[model samples]
Target chain A: MKQRLRPILWLLLREYLEHRRLWALAIGLGLAIIALDLALSLGGQAPAGGLHVMYHSTRALESVSGNRTGTHMIGSLAALGGYDLLLNTIAVLFALTLAVALFSYGLACLYDERRDRSLLFWKSLPISDAQCVAAKAITGLAVLPLVYAVTGLTTVWAAWAINIGLPMTAGPTPPMTAARLVGFSALVLGVLPVYAISLTPGLGWLMLCSAAVRRHPAIIALGMPLLCALLNVFGLPNPIWHWVAAPLVPAGVGHALQSIEAGQAPATALAWVYQPMSQPDPWGGVILGLAFLAAATYCRRRHAVLA
Target chain B: MSESDIVIRARGVSQRFAGRPALTEIDLAVPAHRVVGLIGPNGAGKTTLINRLLGLLVGPGTIRVLGLDPARERHALMQQICFIADVATLPRWLRVAEAIRLMVRLHPGFSAAVCETLLANTDIPRRAHIGQLSKGMVAQLHLVLVLAVDARLLVLDEPTLGLDLLNRRRFYDRLLEHGRSGQRTLLITTHDVAEIEPILTDVIFLDRGRKVLDSSMDALAERFVEVVVPPAVLTEARTLEPCAERCVRDGYALIFDRSRGRDLSAIERLATARNHPTLADLFVAFRTQSNA
Candidate 1:
């Protein structure tokens, strides 16, 4: 197993080296997002309904909970809802940064090789086309996200630090302890797999286009999914539309947002948000992803370079 | 020769692209311990044939390299097969050190020491991206890549396609310095045949998708004789059925196929000078005559 894994691991590293700049861009973009947020908050009037209300409301809840007042219950639920909104929404933005890296990597790896005719050099190695595809899949899907997640969480910490440094508001500001940061890390670890696994089928489709298409692969890569999404916009309501955005939006959040908009309580929304992760693993979706990757690998071998 | 000695065996190999034939009816057997040059003009299917042998391509006939099927068992074949396909095949974004590291991890036979030594002679820095290097440096790097591997077969297709004479010579010198070891077989194709000629033990001439000539260097020298026949003995040389004739200062330089058991004594006596044709001369003769 060690022998078998050595080449696979090396190929994965190759993928990372090939697309390392994209990871840097993702991290940079994540930091830039926080910087932009900092810029807006530092000079301008603080938004009342944003982080301030949540910080103060949380502190008020902790104080009133000593007396078990109805106000404490409402305030606690409100604070939990605010945390959910702030973290999950920012999480989506952070995930987008990683997803962009993942999408570009999947949509370009084989295509660039074939375009540059470097697939011949890669093929010269003892690695098989299947091994090559698997490494790209595992790297772009699994490993890149991990790296992107770290950078993203670091940017989050930076943003959190900035928020903590702000002058005291009129309301009591709840503090973020080390434990809260750890909790945020746990939240990232939990939702990331759901994102990666669900993202696979779309990524596989993108890679298949990379291998098979002759020109303008981006048109096909984004077009089919965009069409499905547009159909949903037109009230076609195809579940296929969901697959288009499946990898982009972390699972359960979309379902919970829809449920909450339909009058579900904010406190009960965690049930909807965690529902996807709490269920049995979506092995079938993963299998479908593998099937797409298998097709992409076939296309690569069939037309890797000119005869 | 024993079957084990034959490094490449192809029988009735043919390939076509979009119904246009790229290679046709090519039969070749290159034995171990020999440096075989696949010489051909542009569009003569040299790269196509090499691609088939490396299993980057599968055509309409049988091809076996190192006693393994190239298309079906390419992963296994690649362990023993090293190839420098062309100038553009190496990834441009790859840093020199990353390439070395990847090779060390991928190929068990890859020697970091050999790679370091090869790099030591060149100006290519460890952190330099391949695209950042000059064309000459790229060729040298390519040589470093293949030569560092301990493989039974080394195939080079236009390894030095568009380099100046100095770089080409440097590449060949480096290739010769590290490429040859024990019973390793080499199959190479290049328009720069003269540079590779001294190292080639056998030569295969390909033209218009067909195998035109397959002979060892010794046999080629013995088979194709070039003689300067004066006007007086030009008629006499015709009896030898020279394949091609070119004008010189005083006589016609006639290329003859003396392998056909003909009496060349008459021409040898009549001609002022007689010698074996160079690989380039022979190649030009074959190409021009076939076109004619």
Candidate 2:
């Protein structure tokens, strides 16, 4: 088992080395966005009206709250709500960037090698073609997303630190705690597996097109579904569009983020992440994705770079 | 070579592209410890046959290299086979050291120390990308990488294409010096047949997807004789049925099949001079006869 796995692990390492620049770009862009956000929020003062509203809301809550328990609950909820809004917005942006990067990367992973005639050299090695395709799939589905998640977690922490230092309001600082950081980390981590599972079909399709198409794989990958949608005008069912959009829509990710922000128990948030797996649509998507993966392997085995 | 000595065996191996046959019923056997040359013109399926042997293409017959089915057990077959398809097969973006490292990691037969020593003889830097190097340097680097492997069979298709005469000479010299150790087999295909003829132990001529000739070098020398006949006796030499004839400065240079039981002493008496035919001469004769 060790001997069989060693070469596969090396193939994966080769993939990472070949495309590490994409990871750098993703991480660098994430940091730049965080830095720019910090510069803007810290360099500028809160508008007078916004500060006035915060002060008035705090005073109103304090005066009406004769019950300590009620006031504390309201304060905690407000704090949690504020953190959720800020963190979820950052998560959404990061997720969007990652989606674009990973989509483009996956589409080009197999295609570029053939285009450049490098596939011949790679095929000359002892590793099987299935192993080669699997390495690319893992790079796109797992490795790239993990890079984004780590960077996203770091950006979230940096933003939280910046918020603590910057005076966002004239009133007392909103309740802040390390638990907010833990919750944000948990949320990103939980959402990533769901995102990976849901996107498997789409990722597999991209790789399959990359392996099968001789020219303009990206256009084919995007245009085929568009053509399918156009065919729907004649009353044909548009399952292709649905398969392409099922993971890209990110409804499950949003739901998990919202649940975590609502101060739901961690177990409940995690359950929301796994909820998509139990759905009929996602199950179908998984089957279709697996079929695509198998096709991709076949195409890769038949592919010749110089031909 | 005996059957047990055969490392590559193909029976009725045929390939086609879109109903156009590239190779038709190719039956071949490659014995170990021999330098075999697969000589052919363009479109004769030299690369196609090599691809089949490497298990890169699956076609209409059975092929076994080192007792493993190329189609079903490519990973295992590749462990003992190394191929240099062309100079451009190496990725242009890979640095020299990275290429070596990748091979060392994936190929248990790869010897990094041998690769380093070979590269040290060239000007290729460890940090230089393949695209940054000259064509000759790329070929050299490729040769270095392949030679570092302790594979049993090495297949090269146009391995020295586009190289200068000096680099090509040095490439083949180093290849012969290191790659062939009496236990390793080499199957090479190239258009420069004259240059490669001296090292070939056996030659196979392929034309239009058909094997025109397959003979060991020693048998080739004994089977065919090139005789320069005087114009006075040209008619007598014609009776021997030479495979090909051409007018030279001295006389009519004819290539005759001595294995036809013709009296060579009689032919020698009629000839001004007689000698063995070169591989190039045999190739031309075979191609001309096939065309006719």
Quick one: best DockQ, which candidate? 1
Query: Could you give candidate 2's per-residue lDDT for residues B211-249 as a string of tens digits?
Result: 888888999988988999888888988888899888988
What TM-score against the true chain A does chain A of each candidate get? Answer: 0.70, 0.81
TM-scores of all candidate predictions against the true structure: 0.86, 0.88
Please give, for residues A1-307, the per-residue lDDT of candidate 2 as tens digits: 7777677778887887788787787778668756665555555533221222232344566778754554564455455445444565567777888888887887888888888877888888898877888777777878888888888888777766766666653224453466756875887776666677777889989999988999999898989888998999999999987876656654556666567666776667777668767778877887898899889888888887244
Q: Model 1, B136-229: lDDT tens per residue?
A: 9988887898889999999998988889999999999987877778567888899998899999899999998999999999998878889998
| Model 1 chain A worst lDDT run, 10 consecutive residues | A168-177
Interface RMSD of each: 1.1, 1.3
Determine the backbone clash count of candidate 2: 0
RMSD of each: 7.2, 7.5
Model 2 chain A weakest lDDT span, ten residues long: A46-55
lDDT of 1: 0.78
Find the candidate with the highest lDDT and give its number: 2
